[model samples]
Target chain A: MLALAWANLTHHKLRTTLSALAVGLGLALFLVSNGLATGSIGEVADRMESVQAELLVLPAQENMVFSGGAVFTPGWTDHLASVADEQGPLATDVIPAYWSQITMGGQQQRLFGIDPEQMPLFLGDRGMVAGHAFEQATAFSQRIRELRATADGQPLDTLLDDDEWSAGLELVIDDRLRRVGQDGHPYEIGDVVRVLGREFRIVGVVESGVAGRVFAPIETLRLINDGGRQRSTMFFIKLRPGLDHLVAARLFTEQLGSTVQVQPTSDYGRRLQQELGKVFMYVNVTNTLALIVCFLFILLTMYTFVLERTREIGILKSLGVTRRGLIGLSMLEALLISSAGAVIGIALSFVAQAIIAMRLPLLTVELPPQHLATAVAIGLVGGIGSALYPGWRAARLEPAVALGYE
Target chain B: MISVRNVQHNYRHNGVVESVLHGVNLAVAEGEFVVLMGPSGCGKTTLLNILGLMMSPTSADSVALAGTETLGLSDSARTRLRRETLGFVFQRFNLLPTMSVRSNVALPLRIRGQHADGAVDKMLDRVGLLPQAGKKPGRLSIGQQQRVALARALIGRPAVLFADEPTGNLDSASAGAVLSLLREFHRDWGQTILLITHNEHLVGAGDRVLTMRDGRLHD
Candidate 1:
């Protein structure tokens, strides 16, 4: 039976080819649309994972830290620390961080200032790629502190206690600025740089694995920003192990009052993902409309084939072919056309993804196995469904009358 | 064997009734070569259609095949019986132009769920056209194409063969060749053949002949 159906299809090569092409075009559109949507969401998740923050504390109503323009008051960090001390084991440590724009190498770069001692606690031991982290015993509260007692006549402690000792002063910059430095090399360790009229030694360079960003010690940032009396833009917090993030978030929000917002880090990532998902959904809907239009075009093409073959149908009926057989033959023809189209469409999707990825490095279209299977199934159903009415008309034809006509 | 009693059919044009066949009755026995002779619009093809189970009578008293009444048979059943027990040849040869002569000859067997490769070879060979089986009907002479259609009709080894002006479109030489092949099949296989024609000269070849005028069969 399949052989017969195939033979019949090959008998009219032009018609069969046209019908298959229509179905193939529809399948290709569906695959490319879904790949783009999936790729967009995946890119967002990847970017968030690279940031490596356990929790992001922000205002409750803010949607995005960068775009929402959220600001934390100067006293907010002190108030959060007090609340953490009162809370049980669920509260770990909170680090104050700020994001600001600064002119560097004739380009505005985003600067991140973090507490040097607490940074390693959250970012792990691989802190600075080029220089060492700040020494823990260094005096943080006063301008100068006495070093280990020396065996000199005046005693080394008195000399080290003077404010002139500045060897430990350090700053960190990102790799991007290193490429665009005035001397063809960005600041390295022991290199003094001026920022906001304050001189600081470049003790290290850090690679955040993100583009367009720089990092500096909190004390040095305070000096550059003319003291840390003003608020910061972002904060990173860590919770005690095995604590329910939602419950901890609720407790923190209640304690901090309405002036600040507390959110679990994962939840923030999910919200960003959802925003990206909406954009993808819009594209999906547009593709669905295009698919419907393609289906209609296929219907028109198949209908024309049926109309042209009315006499053949009549002859088959007169030869005592069953109506079911006729319908089966038509469906088989549709299935073959659709299957061929689906395969071609899937191949075309890969090609399209490659082309798009070349132009947009961040956009990587991936065709999962599920997406391929779904595209083929949709093509088959669409082909068979569109062919139903015409097949019925052919099946119900009266052989005697049809044979009588031209 | 086939029998019909008081079968009537009509055509409706804008709600007006125009009867084509009225009170038509006839029978043809197994292995009997019968001919239905009539002029144009004499309802010969209509009766043949009723007997072939291709169309149903509007006011049928009784139409039976091999002792079974056909009125209760569903459309699909009728179609199956036609595929299994009957074969038809038409005036125009009616060969599928896209298919080779062998495939055209094997169509009825193919429709009956039989493998056509061997049957097609044997049938075409019997018609002395095995050498030309690869050619399409359009490439064959009218006589050869008619023989191909006949081969198709007889490939299933049906109980009866119905030929409606089977040689009508051929020249005299081609028509003679087709008639000779039909007679050879009838004599060799003892097949029951019912042929319809407007030409009266061919009636003598049949074992029995029935004439129709004004939609009723006569002696």
Candidate 2:
């Protein structure tokens, strides 16, 4: 029976090839679309996880990590420490951070302003890829207390300020800046870049994968972003080692009052992935539509194949072939065609991935085993299902009338 | 043996009643060979269909096959009876053009849940086309194709054979060859053969002859 179905398919080379190609194309598109989406989300998730902070306490109402952040008193960091003393174990330490921007050689760069003293508690000083690690890697308050002695009887904030009462902000350049830079000149350690009339010196260069370009002290960013007002954009709290981070985050969220939103750093990556999924919701839509189209195309293709073999069907029936036998034959033919098409589609997915990578190197396309299996399974289910209508119609064909068909 | 009485068959075309067979009756004894001769549209093929169990009689007063009443048989039962008792060869050879000659010959038995084993080989060998068993029906000459069809029809060793204008599409040489094969089946195996044809020469190939005209049979 299978041999007969195969023979019939091979007998019409052009039609069979075309139908298989159509189904193959549908699967290929689905695979490529899904691969790109999955790969991109995985990358973003990995990056978000690298932050390593247990909780991020954001200002009430707005928490855009990039821009338009809600500005609140930098005094909130001071309040958190006292609260930790009272609430004990709610949060071991809170680091105030700010986002600032700068223009260098007509190109805009993002700056992440973090407390230099508190940064070492979460990330090691070795975050610096080149030049030198942060000189103040120890406890920030201890370093400030030591610097206060050399302040020559001045206050700590005034002493931390650089020449002309402006703090000399230390900047770490991201490697991405060098990659996008023009030839003959590149940013190196000690080179001073002017940000808003303030000459900020680059102390180290870090890999862009881990950190951003133009990192400055939180106080420096507050001074620059708010015209000397010491207001931090957000606070990142690191829970003490071995403590349940979820419990700590929940406790801190309640302490921050109703307006503030406290998000666990662990769940942030997943939330970002979910947001990205919503943005690419059309990929799912396309996948479903492609599956439906695949089914219908196979159905119509198999239906036509049966119609062409109407006289042959009649011949079989006259030979005592049963109705179930005819249906099985038709379904087997469709199964073979669809299976071939599925293989073609999977094979072509790699080609599609390669082409996408070549054309847009930043975009990733992956065809994992589970995803491939899902695609193939859908192709086959849809293939067999689509043939049912036509198979049934063929099965019910009366041998008498069909024999008499011209 | 086959027995059919008052077998009436009709079909609708564009919602109008168009009767093809009207009160036809037929009988052929065991090991007997019969030929039905008729003009085009004389309902000879229709009678062949009813007797072959390809179609049921619309108004059969009584119909029996090998002493069993077939008119009252369920569709599946009638189909089983057809598989167990009958075979067919058509004018166009009606070979499954896609299948090889061996597979084509073995199909009748295969549909009845029997393995080909050596049955296909025996039939092909009997038809003198065992050498071409693996070749498709299209690759053979018309006479060779007719012989393959004959082998397929007889592979199950059916109790009866119905050849409907088996030589209508064949040339003189091919037709003579097919008729000769029919004669051989009847003489050597005592096969009960009912063949339909308009050619008067085919009558000599059968032990009995009948004619169909205006949807009724005549002796």
Q: Which candidate leads the pack in TM-score?
A: 2
lDDT of 2 at A227: 44
Cα lDDT tens digits, model 1, A66-123, are 4466667667666665664344644567767766566665555566666666645534
Question: What is the C-alpha local distance difference test score of candidate 1?
Answer: 0.72
> If you superpose only chain B onto the true chain B, what TM-score does each candidate give?
0.96, 0.95
Interface RMSD of each: 1.6, 1.1
Pairs of colliding residues, candidate 2: A117-A140
* Cα lDDT tens digits for candidate 2, B54-93: 8877899877777788877876787788888889898888
Chain B TM-score (model 2 vs. true structure): 0.95
| C-alpha lDDT of residue B103 in model 2 | 86
Candidate 1 second chain TM = 0.96
lDDT per residue (tens digit) for residues A1-406 in model 2: 8777888889778888887887788778778878887775555455445565677776767634345657767468776655442436556677776777667534665577776665554343336567643443223334454654576755555555444333335666656464343333667777776775677767777764443445676656654566445577777777777767777766666766776777787776676656556566776786677667756666776677667778888898888777888888888887888898899899899998887765543356878999899889867876777777777886676788777666
Give the Cα lDDT of each candidate.
0.72, 0.74
DockQ of candidate 2 compared with the true complex: 0.57
